[model samples]
Target chain A: MSTTQPHKKTSGAYRHGDLKKALLGAGLALARQGGPNAVLLREVTRQVGVVPNAAYRHYANQHDLLQAVRSAAMSALANAIESELAKLPSINDPADFARANLRAVGMGYLKFAQDEPGLFLTAFSVPDDLQGTAVPEKAGNSGLNPYQLLSVALDRLVDTGVLPNERRMGAEYLAWSAVHGLSMLFIDGPLRQLSPAQRQIVSQRLLDMVEKGLV
Target chain B: MSTTQPHKKTSGAYRHGDLKKALLGAGLALARQGGPNAVLLREVTRQVGVVPNAAYRHYANQHDLLQAVRSAAMSALANAIESELAKLPSINDPADFARANLRAVGMGYLKFAQDEPGLFLTAFSVPDDLQGTAVPEKAGNSGLNPYQLLSVALDRLVDTGVLPNERRMGAEYLAWSAVHGLSMLFIDGPLRQLSPAQRQIVSQRLLDMVEKGLV
Candidate 1:
């Protein structure tokens, strides 16, 4: 078994105690700028002002570093969604709440994709085991988490008789699929034909269909 | 204006033949095995048993080579969908046709992603102008393309008074979004929790909703 060491630094200019955090932070910045491929171990060490060997004490290799970066990106995305959801009014109506919450999550997700395309791509590109395991606790707590937040909202919708409990998974998948697909298409696919105004109109129409489908 | 040379063989190995097509073919194979990053100029040249500079005669750069790979991937995808649709008996039945066609397209896409994640990623990663300019004659034929095939089927549904003409774009977008989203989720997202059976069930339910909405 390989023994892992903590990234405790004891030097002059590089006295940042947590070299792992520093490397991850710098890696995320690089990922945001250029993409996953840009998050090189050498460049990250250079950014953190550490010897290349120091990085190996924290991350096993570039893949490990990239995994940390990917986790950070997911955590960041979850935080953005939570922040957006918090800004909305707490509606008593379940359907209204669901609508607002879904919109907030979609907006937050789209914002992350647009603002940090490289990091966003990295977040999705990592292997499933890594993503499932390394998703931060903060991400779990945030209203930004699609599965947790959407599932809660969906349960509420079922309780309120807006959607039948039998079709909860169906409705949830449909809602997630529509918004998620549109987000990807807008950001990366062939459907970038819509102008800003047209996009807004189309987005609203999409939301309206989701609402109608649930009802 | 930069003077661009038509396909010139820098090495004697390729003569004056279809070096562009050969490079694209080799690039696709590499992409299938590794992913987009695997399709290196040097590697592709090595595969073709030609000098690295000889590839530049066919593709200006790595980006151009990737674009060709992407175009080939899309064309392959379109062909797969067309072949699947041709096998279905209910050409006039919009709901049935959409269900089968969408599944076929999604399966084809997912299979591509699973079998050749690199090429699949590259297929989506190439810039729009490259993709737009390289629109295959199959895509233009409308009958052979999945999107066009769906559109034609939807048109028939509208003519038969099953679906409203006014909501065609909305319906189209919704259908496309759901299936595309599900495909992405299955391929790269955190939906690996789904068993193959569960995935099929979910897909069928989504198609059911689309049929209900359209009708």
Candidate 2:
């Protein structure tokens, strides 16, 4: 993260170590209401009932805070996928296993967007500058980021011989674009007017297309 | 568009009729530089060398101006697709014509995003209100708006029996999602690192998937 001039505060360490966690929770709330634009360092500190000067310790600037929020978003997305996968029936065939897992990835993604449109958007709102902070490529408490989870699911498709080896190089991107498009269209585009039941049908149709296209 | 209290200026008609066109051109430039956020009413007037209060004669408010810009964006996108289609060979078979037209639409959409990322985004950035603006539902000088263009291409697919009737209802949304997602990823996501030639390959791969899935 890019550094700014240090905040002039002798009591910078006065807050308990929980201050970082508090700031993130408040930031998420702001993002929930106003999208990425609402995630300001000063605003989060104010919401956390801390001196504005103390924000620098946890985040160098707004960009640093945004990256952390994005990381949290990825974890939340991964957890959503896991919850969906856990509810599925046990797989008896290798091909069905591959298809179910792949379909679950998309279903989980679309369902998460339906349930938490705010967090879903925050997950991909890339800032103009990341200040060299690596994206949360590492798994958080949820055990996987979105990219890792998707990669694993696609690998299963190859392992089951459902996806030909020659077509695997960029399959993740193709599948991801379709699912992401459906979610965004539902959340912010013309599909926002659709009833929940109708949105669900569209989601299934999109998933069907993704599966057909991949294999 | 949302209504604002009318500007209290007595000299509303002092400027020539060219002011409206001048403001839209300037607004498009701002959108080109900074997506939706930069297309401010005051800023557009400022760039156009007009009094801030004078903007109301042309636009009720920012939302009103945004709707106009979006209309222009739709026209621009349609024109981009037409330019691409013009370069293609004439096909005699109805099925081949349908496929080529659909492919051209996606290619045009992606190319427009690559060429004018800001305007491309501003085009789809729906305003909070769209009360009375003439959306590009009718054919413009460019021949179509983005949605109308897509509808025409999809209609051709069914007319030629290239796509089955049962799959026709929501197929446009599915196809749109794939292409839109690909363009968004190419513009702002991890795919931004791809070189132009590399992007070309990915674009074709996505179109192949889209065509296969739709048929």
Candidate 3:
């Protein structure tokens, strides 16, 4: 079990309050390798050179640790979205900006899923009512979580008259269903074997469908 | 261990050729209860009143059994789509009938995902290259698999001029992405708690998006 150590650090005891962070680091490493199912409390503690009881001092159970890891994963996903949003060139038209914002959010989401599938899967491993829960832990440097970012993009569309006010009610679900479904298909479904070039084509096509369909 | 027996038959030995079918029956029961991961050889054999080795004769390994169960689940999903297709009233207008056919396929998929989430999850547990792999085992009564059924609907759209022939190349993926993504969100993601009426509304809206987007 010790053969595949999480890091090259010696198996020394963690300094006072750093154990939780250390355990979380180890858990993230595990999730990066395998997916949500890989982040076990025992494995995390062992990787951190501590006993499982020490982990319990920070997290009540494996589920609690998983939740923490999931939050971090969500934050990472938000950061990915922010990175894409930040890359947009200044647009004069509000409609073009709104359209670009929505596309950036989706492109960021697909890129994250492709690049960090394990963490991506871990981020959504547990279900939560994400309708309006804008907790800071899941936020990016822009102070918005992934879902909130999507809502903002859609709201921009409505404001710009690109997407009608009446159609904006649950447009999040409609758009999210398309992008998220394509991500899942790319990551874990039959499309898993698609080449990166093929994936790019399909991804663009899916986004086109969402943009055209939503409005 | 036997408290939740797969069937009410006594712990008697199986007849020569009946063991394979009995084991598959038990495996399907397990899949219905807990999705793909639940179909274990040991548990299946135990449920079938046979030793572990008895299962090896039928299934080379757990994966082989899971493949069978997944195929069965695929067939079940195809049947659900076919059942919805059967409900369509013969219309005089070709375009209207084509549109209705596509909607019926999407509706049947969503209904099956809601009504049989466990089996739905099990069906998509493994990632096989589903493009053009129309095997007999996964076919419905109409001799069409789920992917093929979606393809047929999309083809009908082009045939009736509801969808442009140029856009018909990969419209199946676009439509499947929306319907499948919505299904996953309903069953395992943040949208799991949506009420049936709300789900119904969302389902129609998603189908609407697909129909509009595809064309």
Candidate 4:
């Protein structure tokens, strides 16, 4: 394994070998502070202490930088879900595991939205072509992308006979739609009327419905 | 029926009486052209050929003006849904009527999202305090808000004995979550890959699940 230090030095500012990472770091910071609109190439380069034109070496334009930042945001969200899943006690019962997994993921997603609204918005709002290129490889220890995590939970349900295989896609869509819809509502809709504790109750109720439907 | 058009005219560059309405119109035009961010008070005033300060008399700031524009957008959406509901052939079956009503509402919402993406976004996004003041009152119309329309359909399910009244809120949330999630995906997510025809099928399938769950 290559040991990576916490703060490795790169070459001169203009020709820094890690300029790509620097650009993404600056872009994510800007997104967190303002929003997608704030991720301008000139300003990002300025923050990185490099000339505007030098940024072109790493990212073709502002859109390119925004895409990179968005990919990072998605990866960050996936990682949070993974961490939450790891904390749950192992269950021999697949249906119980599915419920726990869904709750963990939903809570992680909502927490991400609350903690990093700009990054969360950017992760969802970036255009498709950019997303296709920038999303991290979905293999190795990461085990799953957000979609795949949900898919696996559904697959486990099928394997354990909690849900019929014929109901796979419909079940997946239903589960996703509920949690995703609630997340959007919490982040951007009238559902903000609920206090944090109330929101938690609502989230769990939604997850319960999904598990009940699957069972 | 009282047929009354309130036409209170103002003097000079300050169109006092209908300045708010005029500003909303101008703002909507701007939003249609270039999403929500394009809606600037100065640009709206310029488009109306009024002095910049004249706009402040009607709108305290851009936030207030945007909220007005958002409310107008939602009112237009509600009207569209009402018209669609009116056009449906009368059926004796309440469940059938519920299905038809839900479909019409979904189609209207999707149409609004496609036709006026910016305004649709603003319509949902304005802060609650700002929205409460701006949402048009439908006096003597059976107290119909958009959410209530869905609630009425759910009530039909209860009346038909398809769903228990105790589960009304859960069922309502489930249905809303599915449709609202599908709408957001169509408007802003990867579902854009589907043709319009394919999208319609996906939407109908979603609605089928909601109706099925009531059984």
Candidate 5:
């Protein structure tokens, strides 16, 4: 797509304002291949057929470009979770719905990590806290980032009386820690070689642990 | 120490094969500051006052040197856990002892990550499977590596009838994932800036989740 539309025209002038979009697209492609560290300004600019100085207008430094890629990666993660949330069947029990929502959030997270390990690493590459940024850029179609989605699921548990009121506080972090840890094990740790079936079994067990332990 | 005794004599000959020890010393020092990626052969050789070829006699390449550093880092982690185990008070109840042991293991793992983030990162940098190498070089004084230490604690839980026998098979991986994920969060994720007291509280809660969930 970038090949069809260069950042600059034959007149040596800018091509309106599609430069930022092209830069982000290149950045996301780099992140998909080599993670956060690979989202270099020079490389992205080169890919977009622009000079480093032209790229600098959009990103002051490599960190700036990386942050943009990080946000996109996070949004992709939020979208993955949303995909899982969208698959829920109609249920009457609030507690059951809450449990299912929470499970879907976790399964989506693990699936994303396995299918797109590079992007998964890039999403959390930034040192942003667990209170994820809810800005529109970082949100999925549901208007919530991954952390917010997890928080909402945990809140559902409390609202449905599946989790105690006192335990509701910081419940998201506990569950996130479990699921995040499992994802790390699968992507970068010893569990990297786990077969798809094995990953599914372990993932369910881990979610069960978080579900059972939190309540 | 290498400054006092060079790896080679003035005659340009090997000095009693202490080159490997000196190289390792330099590698560990580098790893302490820069994690696994910092343990470069050229850099270590420079610090050891040796040429690249001389260093090659000990480490075939950067990966070889990194693997050695990884082993030392793993050993240090095991030692830290052993220190925690050493402080346990005498207990009459087997179940209580088993629970305390498991708690100590998790606490020690967390403490090491916070105290020595670099080495903690290095320890698991190799991506070796969770069945950690039981070689003497990677083990602590107790003749067990970190993974083995964790396994022993889980085994005690099973033997004491605290954890179900059926659940004891893959318990180590589950426990490892939770604790390891927390450590990563503290070291590289959003929890990096957490105060010590807050870290302690969250850490205890995480350990609680693992203990309650696993059982």
Candidate 6:
């Protein structure tokens, strides 16, 4: 897809204006194989068949490149949640819809971690300096980051009067922590041994617990 | 500390049975400096003035040594939690004591992560095979791993008649996940930026959420 057309080759200098996107794609591929640790700059340059200098033009440093990849990961995670949200049957009542939608947010989150463990890790492990920059929901381009989506879901709970306004303060942290912990345990801890069916039961139970705990 | 006494230096062969302990200590120090990756066998041996063969005698591979380090980390974590439990005011009622004790457990976990972030990472990042083996509560001699402590707390909730038998099927996961997520976020996620006072507030709020959510 990056091959230049003959008509566009009139200029002597090489022009890969979409180099940033290519580099990010290569970074994601590297992360997929060896995790965040693998997204090295020179390696990414080689993967994209670009000279180191060209890659540098797009990313000032490895951290910059990783931040972009993390942002992409956030977008992917949000899309995964969106997929789950789509799978749910239509809900009539506002509270019921909010609750179901929030549950879908968590289920999508867990499913993404389970299915795309590497991406999930890279997404959440955005390095210290680059964190706020890659926030999925705040990404001017992407519709919502995971945290923003979670916040929206929690807002719905408050709006429906399911959770008191006083209790709603930082309610997202409670639900997020529970779901995130389960995902890490499932992907990187002892829970990795659970069979798919057992995992489903456990996931549902965990979400149920989070729902109950938050309200 | 493993240095041989002058009186016992007649033997040409070096026999340090404490080599394992020294290696594990060195491994923990390395992890402290650079997380799990720095706990390499060669580096550990170099740190302890031992040859690779001597290190190999105690640990077949880096993973084995890491597992030992992870176990030590768990022991350290249990000690930290035990330390917190000791600081609690004496409560006459079993239920009240249990509640306070459970809260201490979460506080200790967070404190450990905040104060000794490196060790906390090593403790929870126990290599897959070493996971159940290094459980914080089941350290045999240590009295209770974190899981068992959580279970005891949940048992208290059930005993207090606050939570029904059906509701307590797996309440520990709820509390553990919430607390663990908070720790991870504090140490490695965006929550790292929060001030100590802010963290304290959030910590108490999260624990309250867990307490309320479980029942």
lDDT over C-alpha atoms for residue B40 of model 4: 82
For residue A12, model 6's alpha carbon misses the true position, in angstroms, by 14
Backbone clashes counted, model 3: 0
Cα lDDT tens digits, model 6, B37-130, are 5678998898777687787777888887887887777777777887887899988987788788789989988888777777777777634332
Q: Assess each prediction's global lDDT (C-alpha) against the native.
A: 0.67, 0.79, 0.81, 0.68, 0.80, 0.76
lDDT tens per residue, model 1, B102-134: 555545544444445455566666352222332
A96: Cα error in model 4, Å: 4.9
User: Of the candidates numbered 1 and 4, which has the greater DockQ value?
Assistant: 1
| Models sorted by DockQ, best on top | 6, 2, 3, 1, 5, 4
Which ranges in model 6 have alpha carbons more than 4 Å from their true place?
A: A1-19, A40-57, A61-63, A126-142, B1-17, B40-46, B49-54, B126-143
Task: Report the number of the highest-lDDT candidate.
Answer: 3
lDDT for A154 in candidate 3 is 94
Please give, for residues A66-121, the per-residue lDDT of candidate 4 as tens digits.
Answer: 77787777777777777777888998787778667777776776677666667666
Task: Compose the digit string of candidate 4's lDDT tens values, residues B1-215.
Answer: 35554433444433345776777899988866565667888999888777777878878888788777766666666665666677889888877776677777666656666666665655655342321433334321344656666667677777877678877777777677766676666666656566888877776666666666544
| Cα lDDT, model 6, residue A137 | 41
Q: What tens digits encode model 1's per-residue C-alpha lDDT throughout A1-215?
A: 35554444544544457878999999999878776777889999999888888998898988888888887877777776677677889788777776677777666666666556676666766342222433233353443455566676677677777788888888888887877777666656656666767767767677667766765
Name model 2 segments beyond 4 Å from true.
A1-17, A126-142, B1-17, B126-143
Model 1 CAPRI rating: acceptable
Candidate 5 per-residue lDDT, tens place, A1-215, comes to 75646444677756645788899999999888777657778899899887887877878777777788888888899999999889999889999999999999999999998888788887765322223322324787788988789889988999999999887755666788778888877876667677999999989888887888887
Comparison by DockQ, 2 against 6, better one: 6
- Candidate 5: chain B TM-score equals 0.88
Judge the docking of candidate 6 as incorrect, acceptable, medium or high. acceptable
The stretch of ten residues in a row with the least summed lDDT in candidate 4 chain B is B131-140
Clashing pairs in 3: none
